[model samples]
Target: MTKREIDEVSGVETTGHEWDGIKELNNPMPRWWLWTFYATIVWAAGYTIAYPAWPMISSATSGVLGFSSRGDLKAEMTAAETAKQDYAQTIAAKSADEILADDQLREFATAAGAAAFKVNCIQCHGSGAEGSAGFPNLNDDDWLWGGSADAIYHTIAHGIRFEGDPDTRYSEMPAFGDMLSKDEIRQVSSYVASLTGNSTDEQAAAAGKQVFADNCASCHGDDGTGDREFGAPNLADAIWLYGSSEAEIARQVRTPRHGMMPAWSARLGDTTVKELAVYVHSLGGGE
Candidate 1:
């Protein structure tokens, strides 16, 4: 038979339609490819039966094994808690001071305190305890409350400015607005500025001495040296809480400034609070 005739008579036919003088073959899919397509369908059917593959209006189909992603997380947490129990039990038996001495307990406390500080103290104390405008530096020697280990522990246990905790440290810088005249406040501010070697109007500072004697002497001492028990900051030292500017001082005298540090005892738990105290104490300037 001739080649053209043979092609025409072959059972594998050509598409009846042609485009641009070219005809397409009407070919069956490869046997292997067909088998693969069928296998995919069968696998999908099995998967749908075994797992949560279908979605409903308000819920998804529960798999036969009743597996859940949340269950995996809970299992992981349970294991971690089990591991932590030993350390927790050991810490519970020791005092904060003893924990500081023990290498393992100290390491654990440091880690725990750092985590809690990031969560709680960082907002006011800064990530590195650098402190902000009103907040005191945990890294510095100047402590409103004493810097001893016990002192820090006490402060953390009972937060300053916390309402309903009568034992919580409390101090109020009386506003000069009702008590001292604006001129007197300005003078006192100038005198406060002078304590830090910050430039002040000489006349204002002169007038401020009288104002200091009358209003600020009780808590700040006659020379602005400050009272530790009262938490009154020393104006003589360069450490300015609200800022050393004449305006800031004047504003403080006129409308006073009160800063409250949140107590961390309950939030950080006892061991962590102790660790934070130790960490702050270790900071170079800590008293």
Candidate 2:
């Protein structure tokens, strides 16, 4: 049997380990440190039994506490749905004017309308409602069929030139290519462009003024002011749906492009359509 060695310097025992001429001291860990290490082991064991810890083949082992993250999420979602239902019921029972009159209802309707617009309208009207070449910007006060709340509501509910809805707003600009010569078309195009100061040829525009009076003044008023009854847009305004350039104007003169919007009454129902109208009106554009 190998006898344990004791250090000669302080009379402490050696650990029977040696590297070259050096010996390791048999020092015991402090009581506090030992207790802490033991406590950690006990905590870890208790935690494993109280919470989910083990991995199984198909699923994890549920701990004794029986808590589930999915259940908590479902409870939260149910509460939100219940709250939303209350507001939805109230909106369904009220008219557009009545809802607007009540501050609480109007706020709820505006938020709901904004949400619907993001889902259904961002494709055409743009994310910020700025609009593109063919689409009309919802952010602006310039409106073709009038910007009144009732008018906007009607347009949204029934749509514009949509074949699916019989009550859809309808207007047709006759293609002048069928009746007028190419030069005449350019002349008329310049006249229309000149209304908004977008014309390139002054002489042509002067000559086209007569052409507009003879051919186009019926729908678009004599001074180029649009009639809302005819769904005609104001040619005098700089807000051109297609474009403000002479070439674009000439193209439109030759073959007028009609814009269309689908009726939402059937698809979205009355409540949502009213909400959408309120939201669009509150964008600082509705009259």
Candidate 3:
């Protein structure tokens, strides 16, 4: 056994271990630091015993205090739902128009509706309600059906071209590809495009005017303004569900693509549907 050596310069004990020419000092840690380290170990042990810490194969050990984050969250959610019960009940009983007429109910419905829209309608209507191709933009004034609160509620409750619902808003534009000659389809396309100041062919548009007046004027007004009762789209508007280009217009003239919106009332219920109508009606374009 080798005896520990003392440093000649400081007269302190050496660890008796050396690397090269350097010797290590046998310096003990400060009493405060050592005590703190021991205290932390004790605290960690206490914490483990008092709270959930150990994991098992199927579950974790429930500590003595019986605290659970999931339980806390469930309690909070229950409290929130309980508080909203009255408001939800009132909404269920009231019509969308009646709800909109009340300022407080309208405010609540709009906020709730906005939340629902993100979950249900955002895929087609977009996050900001700006529609994509084949979908109608909700923020714009142009509505194929109608834009009023009642109208919007009815449409949302029943849906557009939804075959499942007997009361669904339904309209069918005859596919002109089967009905008209190719040249006649092109002429009518030029006329329709001309309504929106998008046509280039003057003679074709001229000939197409008669074609439109004869075939399209019955559903779409003589001036190309839409008929809300028939759910016909206004041809003169800048907003187009498909596209406004000549090729797109020609394609629609040949074979119109009718978009379908699901009847949300059947799936989401009346209260949520009313809220959705209120939210959509508040989107600046609602009449």
Candidate 4:
């Protein structure tokens, strides 16, 4: 064994290790640091004995404490559900309108509805309830059916054009592609476009007035304002389920695109439906 060398400048003993003529000093670890290191080792050993730490072939070692994160999470979830029981029961007992009358209950319903909307409705209606191309935007005043709380509740409970639910709000716009000529379809589309904004073809709009009265007036109303009773969308409003373009109008006049919503009440339960209705009503446009 080689004898230890003393560092020249510091007068401290040098470690046997050296690199590029630079010798390492064999300084002792600080008392605090050494204690901390030993404490960590002790803690590790105690932790292994008290809580799960070692991994075996098929399973991990269950420690003496027998504590599980899963058990803790389950207990917390049960506590939360129990706390909501009163509010849930009260919501079930009250109609959406009745719940609105009670400030406390209404608040609870709105929060609950928001949670439900995030989980279920966000996929189609969007996270902000703004809606996609085919879906109806819930934030706006324009409604294909009606916007009242009761009406909204009815739609949520039964759904729109949902085949699964017999009482689903149903409306069918007869596809005029087979019945009407291309020119007639274009003419009517131009007229419909002229209702809300300036029509691209003024001459077509002028000529299409008679075509609209003859074919579309009964369902869309003579002025193209729409009839909610028939679930006809208002052509007068800029808010459109499909689009506002003349070409989009022509396409709708020819083929028509129908949208469907699932009956949420059957899936989420009546209380949740009421909460959703109350929450949706509070969004902005509900009557």
Per-model TM-score versus the true fold: 0.66, 0.76, 0.77, 0.75
Which scores better on TM-score, 1 or 4?
A: 4
Which of candidates 2 and 4 reaches a greater TM-score?
2
Instruction: Name the lDDT of candidate 1.
Output: 0.78
Stretches of candidate 2 above 4 Å error? 1-68
List the lowest-lDDT window of 10 residues for candidate 1: 1-10
lDDT for predicted candidate 4 compared with the true structure:
0.90
| Preferred candidate (TM-score higher): 3 or 4 | 3
Give the deviation of candidate 1 from the true structure as CA RMSD. Answer: 6.4
**Ranking of all candidate structures by their TM-score, best first:** 3, 2, 4, 1
What lDDT tens digits, residue by residue, belong to model 1 across residues 109-141? 667667777888888889998998888878777
Candidate 4 deviant stretches above 4 angstroms? 1-5, 15-22, 38-71, 100-115, 118-123, 126-128, 175-186, 282-287
TM-score of 2: 0.76
lDDT-superior candidate, 1 or 3: 3
The lDDT per prediction is 0.78, 0.89, 0.91, 0.90
Compared with the true structure, what per-residue lDDT tens digits does model 2 show for residues 1-287? 98878899978899988899899999889999999999999999998888778989987868899877778899999999998888888888877767788898889899999999999999999988888989999988898888866688889999999999989999999998898888888888899999988888999999899889988999999998889999988999888899888899889888999988999999998889989988988898888
Where is model 3 poorest over a 10-residue stretch in terms of lDDT? 80-89
lDDT of 4 by residue, 129-200 (tens): 998798889999987778887788989999989999998999889999998899989888998899987588
Candidate topping lDDT: 3
lDDT over C-alpha atoms for residue 116 of model 2: 95
